[model samples]
Target: MKKVDTNKYTKLTLSLERIRGIITELPHNGHRFVVLYDDKPDKQGYIQTILEDDTLGEQSPYLLETRVYHTEDTFSHYRKSCTKAQEIFPYFEDFYKDIPFSYENWEEVTKEFLED
Candidate 1:
């Protein structure tokens, strides 16, 4: 499993706007890690695990490496966020998932399938 400097993001209080900002504020090109987790059991356990890697595309400092932890758990979370990511930012799935552990967009698509 990969690790992120949680301290880096923890220094800042997170809210919906903040999560959105991380996504919006990131630089255009770079390996990005976008994690969406369930705010249930142990808290955002699964989703956050997904976005801990900043290894996508060629390494680029200009890259906006970040993880967006949303308060969403279960298939519904995936449905909502996945849909919103598409609507919020086209090519959103493409933004992340090339990295390992992603299972590609399939993790997001068959979220319910995987859970069961």
Candidate 2:
């Protein structure tokens, strides 16, 4: 089954498997990606970001970091919902900024990366 996000601002509640599927589809190079989902009893949701760490050896060039975002205190966190990095563009707030899209927007964000 496929999970869809009707709203583009709300965090997505999905299983780890689904989240992994989305991660696999994201670009592994040149871009840092974020994945948002609830994998535990906590409904607050988790944000996973993959950064291309040049410091790491060629065999492992990515660094995965996980952060928690509380819905009530979203103003203090990066994105309000689950998000994945679409490109390697620069942002003053960086990945800590609110995500512009939702789970349904996965295709919208990764479209260009996948096509490449």
Candidate 3:
């Protein structure tokens, strides 16, 4: 028998305005912003992952990129600062928001689904 991964993927849904508010303050709180794109034709929403800048390192200097995922084939981008993060907010659907995750417990919080 093949063992299947039973971990479930979860996402929070909020208004776009709320999402923008959270992104604006990420830099002040020593955090980075991530946007997860949904490729499903019927689902036009996106998922936001907030990660610590220091934990991810500084390999890429560009403000945007094409990949950012661990267990899925979704398109994602990470921004190190508020300004760079906000640049792409306007392109997001007007229906998503993200709450700040504590850096100290980020791993615990994301470990379930983030694990490959």
Candidate 4:
């Protein structure tokens, strides 16, 4: 039998206005953002930041980088200025099953999804 991993993953929460501020403050041509997850124990959290490597001419790997902090102390220590709380923990195996658009569309969808 395969060993089952029982760790948890949380959803990082931020206000719509705050998210907008993050977007607005990002440098031009910055990495695009998308929210994606995997089904493994110890999964911490998800972020909407996904990026495609444009320099590669063909079949470049898509980047699924997300910044996840599992503890308030760690989060606070690393992200001292970010006050958003991580309140929702959903198992990775059961979340984001029917994302309506491709990762390439995250910028638009994220703006829409976080709109007030």
TM-score of each: 0.29, 0.31, 0.35, 0.26
* lDDT (C-alpha, whole model) for all candidates: 0.33, 0.36, 0.38, 0.31
Locate the minimum summed-lDDT window of 10 residues in model 4.
76-85
Question: What are the per-residue Cα lDDT tens digits for candidate 3 across 1-116?
Answer: 10111012224444566555655555444436545444445444343534334344432221322233443454333323222555546434322223322223122233333447
In terms of lDDT, model 1 sits at: 0.33
lDDT of 4 at 40: 48
**Per-residue C-alpha lDDT of model 2 across residues 20-83, encoded as one tens digit per residue:** 4444444433323544543345444334445354344233333333333445444123322223
Q: Write model 1 residue lDDT over 33-86, tens digit each, in one string.
A: 444333335443333212222343122222122233344444322322231222
How far residue 107's Cα lies from its native spot in candidate 2, in Å, is 32
List of clashing residue pairs for candidate 3: none
- Number of the top-ranking candidate, with lDDT as the measure: 3
CA shift of 97, model 1, Å: 24
List, residue by residue over 10-105, the lDDT tens digit for candidate 4: 344443444444333323334244344434455444434322443542233333323344463232111111112121112112234322222332
- The TM-score of predicted model 2 comes to 0.31
Q: Model 3 — TM-score against the truth? A: 0.35
Give the poorly placed runs of model 1, Cα more than 4 Å off.
1-13, 28-31, 42-86, 89-116
lDDT of 3 at 1: 10
Count of backbone clashes, every candidate in sequence: 1, 3, 0, 3
